[model samples]
Target: MAKVSILYPIFRNQQDVLRDLKTIHNQTEKDVDLLVLDQRSGKNKDSKSRVLQLFPKVNWIEKQFKNIAEMMNFGFSRAASDLLIYMPPNIGLKPNLVQAYSDAFQSSGMPGMIFADYAEVLPDGKIEEKRLRDYDGDITERGNFGYVKGYSLKAAKAVGYYDEQFNRAEEYDFRLKLSEHHDLIRVPDVRYDVFISPEKASEKMSVGASKLFYPGEGK
Candidate 1:
């Protein structure tokens, strides 16, 4: 059995799925189970064949989830690893992403969540590294942590998983909830490179958490 479960939720993003699958396959830590919760009908046989040939070990689970929270909840329920990572299709992880988490969590007595730093993949293929802020009550609450977070399955279950109400801001909401009762840490490591729009990035500054709120839910 794998020691970690990467919950990668996707819609109809086959191309990006292929890329992310390849990235997962390249992780230094091979003891991992990738649970791709795809909320779409199905891909064509040709595309599936091509990708599967490259990484056939994927644990593909097709489901119709309403939002990110629901998709994550489904993955959490079926997690095979003690460590659960919420990895979106758009995110790009380094070769040591899983290995980094494994090493850190094992040494830190397995905190509720171990968050790491990330780099931005610029439009021209340039990489700009962004480190996580030093853990502080005022900093985390006002601002937000970047992408690339390693969640503890035990802690996630205690908080009742994620609230399906928050869509894009699920990470923000989740961290807020986790910080309330768990030991949140800011590890200094560039383990991921998230692709962002040039317009959204402020010159050399990092983009904060995405604001994904439903009509009924206030932001």
Candidate 2:
């Protein structure tokens, strides 16, 4: 059995989907299973077909939905691994990231999650520091940690999967909930190059800004 399951919920970005899939497949640790959830349905048939051709080994789950959270919840429901990583389509994995996560999981047991620092690359190729804002604020005083960045897969069932109500900051809220039970360690050795696409950033901002108005509705 794979030690970790990477749940990638795909929408309409066919151009970069293959690259994302390839990045996960090329991870240093071979014990990770890539679960690609196709939420594009009929409109994404061409994209799905292309993805299947590139990675026939990947476990593909097709769903017709406009709600991103609903599709993610469905994907989590189908995951078979104890550890689950909820990630965006634009993020690329750095070497040893999976191993680092696995090692952290073994060391801490239940409620332990391993996250790492990341570089935010702009369209002009300028790199900026990326900070992970969760719960109250940056938990850097927690330990052996650099600045926090990127998503993580750890103790899925124990931490409780992403809330379907939050299509935007689901990972943030989920991480906050996980922190309640598990201690988050930001490993400096493992890092991911998270590209901030203008389109995606805009969409996320819109969802995040509106989430405040909705309150617990996002939970």
Candidate 3:
């Protein structure tokens, strides 16, 4: 089996999916399993064909999920490796991301979850560094860590997986639960870049904890 499995959720953004796929394809870590969870409907056939033609090694699954939590739960269940990394469709990864995660997982005694700092590509093509704070058990609920994260299958299952009832902030809820039992390790290196449009960048800067956690609620 592969050393780590990447669970990527692909929505309607085909270009983003392809870009992320290319980055994953060029990773320095060779012993990696990639599972593309395509949340598109049957009418959207182009993504499947294009994905297959480009990255044949990717294990693609086309299914309709009720929410992000449900999709992630299903993905974790199907992951071949105990160490699972969650890669969103909108990020650009460094070549060493997988390798870094693998090393951190092993060296840190396979923590419940592992996350690292990331750069953000702004609307004007400028890059901004986002250094996430280390895990604080006392303020876990109020903390807003960046989106990209890695999970341990055993730890996740022990917490009963993600709460599917939440339409948003499912990850935040899961992290809180996971932190209760296992350590949430933070790798200090910048491993990925989040491409942000003008609107998103503005919202990101102006939003408070409520808006940041449960996005699209006030819209």
Candidate 4:
């Protein structure tokens, strides 16, 4: 089987989905499985059809989820590989992302989760580097670390997957639990790019700020 499985959630942005898919399809690593979870509503039928037309070989699933955490839990349960990459919509992967993650998994003695530095694509078309802090098991760390992240399927399942009750900060809750049993490794290299719209960026900031006050909940 593949060394890593990429779980991608598709939303309303067809252009962003297509762009990220192209990058995924062009990856230098060949032994990577991609599972696309399309969460678009019935009104987005045309967009869904276009995606299928362009990438007919992709493992596409049409399922509506009540929350992002539920969608993530479903994706992790279906991933074929033990190493899972949770790649949200509007994120761009580097050519060596899979290979780098695979290498980090092996070299780090198969940590529970892996995260790397990333670049941000500004609206003005400029790229800004975002170097993430090392995982120090700090409860006060920002919740919006980045969009693309790596997780150990076994570790996630061990922690009972993500909590569906949280529509926001689900990942934060999941990571806090995962870190309890396994190591959270940070790769120093930049492996992906986050393309955040202004509205989404604002939402992320709010989530990050809220996480500071409620760090004791997930534990």
Candidate 5:
């Protein structure tokens, strides 16, 4: 069985979906699965056909829900692997991310959550690996872990998955809950690449300004 399952909750972004899919398929860790939870149903279905053609191996699951948190919760509940990484569409992954995450789990004695630093990719092609504030509730409470990701099924079930009540900042609340029991470990390596887009009204929906967009960030 694959050790890692990357859950991608996609709404709509065809411009780079195919490219991103290829980036993930090429990860160094062969024992990994990518599950795309497609929420772009009916009139909003834009990139479905293209994605299927470019990446037939991807496990595509379709559902209609405007709430991002609920979509992520569904993905979490359905992940076949014990460790799942909740990510969004159009982001790039480090070739060694899956292997790194698996190793982190083993090294930490299989902790509930494992996260690493990330290099933010700007439109201008500048990549910066900003230092992350290692797992601290007070800091986490004010701002979700910037680029960290991943959680174990055992630990997730104990605290309950992302709260549907919060489409925004759902991760912040979820991480805070898990912090009560499990310790959020940090890996210094940069594992994920996040590209910032123009501001949209949806950005405001985050539970608060201090929310994690990636499930990996909640912790």
Candidate 6:
């Protein structure tokens, strides 16, 4: 079995997905399988074809999804490896990132997730360090490093899978489920640059949490 199975689902973000395709193709560990679920159809067919051309070896599946969570779950269902790593379309992996993940999973012998501190790079090339607790508002009180939203992969059949109901906070929900079964680890490695485009990433802070999450549903 391949050591890792990477699940990356794409919507209209063709350009960013292409960049990630190259990163996966260049991975030092060729023992990884990549499953890309293309979520664009009709007018974007040509662009979708172009994106698939970049990754001929990938297990490509096409279907429109209501949201990111559904698309990711679709990709996860097609995965064949024991370990499933879910990442966004804009994240860039280092050459040894998969190898590192495989090593971590092997050495740890614990069925759980593992993530690292990531460096966020802007389109113009400015860089900033991001952490799991950055947006929590109580940074000093929180640990410096831990599981972020979702960067690790546990046993594919274990911990269930991503909850499709969550448009956002899917990682938060996944961690909650994972905590009940296994330990989560934060590896101190800068393995990838999770690039978030300014327009999509820098949304107004004034946007209410209800808007960001589920609205009109009391917690």
Please give, for residues 26-118, the per-residue lDDT of candidate 1 as tens digits: 864667888877666675455466666876777776678877677777888899876887675554455555565665566667457544444
Q: What TM-score goes with each of the models?
A: 0.63, 0.56, 0.65, 0.64, 0.63, 0.60
**CA lDDT of 195 in candidate 6?**
25
Count clashing pairs, candidate 4: 0
Clash list (residue pairs), candidate 5: 148-216, 149-216, 150-216, 168-206, 168-207, 169-207
lDDT of 2 at 32: 71
- CA shift of 124, model 4, Å: 29
Error of 4 at 99 (Å): 2.6
Locate the minimum summed-lDDT window of 10 residues in model 2.
134-143
Candidate 6 weakest ten by summed lDDT: 139-148
Give candidate 2 misplaced runs (Cα > 4 Å). Answer: 112-160, 167-174, 183-219
In candidate 2, residue 4 scores what lDDT? 71
lDDT of model 5, residue 31: 68
Residue 134 lDDT (model 4): 31
lDDT (Cα, tens digit) per residue for candidate 4, span 74-111: 88888888888877655444455555556666666754
TM-score of 1: 0.63
- For residues 134-185, write the lDDT of model 5, one tens digit per residue: 3332212223343436777777778788776764345545554554444332
**In model 3, how large is the Cα lDDT of residue 70?**
86
lDDT of 2 at 153: 40
Q: Would you list the C-alpha lDDT of every candidate in the order shown? A: 0.57, 0.52, 0.61, 0.60, 0.56, 0.51
User: 65-173 in candidate 2: lDDT tens per residue?
Assistant: 6565666566666666656666555544443444445555555565545344443333343333343332222222222232323333444455566665764445544
Best by lDDT: 3
